[model samples]
Target: MHASDTVDEQLELAADLPPWEKLASKARALKVMEEANKIIEDFPTWEYWVFFLLFMTEFFLAVYVSINLLK
Candidate 1:
């Protein structure tokens, strides 16, 4: 079938590709995670507090609306 020829070509192309190690190794993964943690830890404390307060406000607002609807 014509469809099978396309599939075979795709499979052959995939088989010919070289191994990519960018995110495939444990050491590379750990390095990426460390970099991410460093960025998050460097983020401003004030911003975290502001986000937390905003989230709590939204949560309580949702609860209030739900209770009012049930009344």
Candidate 2:
């Protein structure tokens, strides 16, 4: 093969390498973001307070009904 042909092949190989590296980096970053989002979603927050309030309300209602039944 000629010198120019070898240089062209080298350039093509270099060009291909960078795009693969960039795609891999992007995939890694996306995976990290997805994991972070899952962690955030799993965590209990103010929503837990709302659930606690509802549970308390139900417990009070049950107690009230039981007391009235006893009377």
Candidate 3:
């Protein structure tokens, strides 16, 4: 059988396994995992970015208000 057939077979088998087993199979299969890990490692987490945005926006708003108040 070809590679595609092998993948199909694995998928069919996975369907019969437990939910965690399905996740384990993909986690163990590292074909696309290196890139996925790279992305995970490179990006700041969601919480950090959200806080950064709020802080920057607050800073800018304070500055604008200060300028307008003085005029």
lDDT tens readout by residue for model 2, 38-70: 888998899899999999999999999999999
Question: Between which residue pairs do clashes occur in model 3?
Answer: none
- On a 0 to 100 scale, what is the lDDT of residue 43 in model 1? 83
What are the TM-scores, per candidate, against the unseen true structure?
0.39, 0.43, 0.44
What digit string (tens of lDDT, one per residue) describes model 3 on residues 1-71?
Answer: 23233444555667878989876655544434555668779999899999999999999999999999999
Model 2 TM-score? Answer: 0.43
- Global lDDT scores for all candidate models: 0.62, 0.68, 0.70
Best by lDDT: 3
Model 2: lowest-lDDT 10 consecutive positions: 1-10
Cα displacement (angstroms), candidate 2, residue 57, comes to 16
Error of 3 at 27 (Å): 18
The CA lDDT at 66 in model 3 is 100
Q: How many backbone clashes does candidate 2 have?
A: 0
Best by TM-score: 3
Which regions in candidate 3 have their CA more than 4 angstroms from the true location?
A: 1-36
Error of 1 at 36 (Å): 23
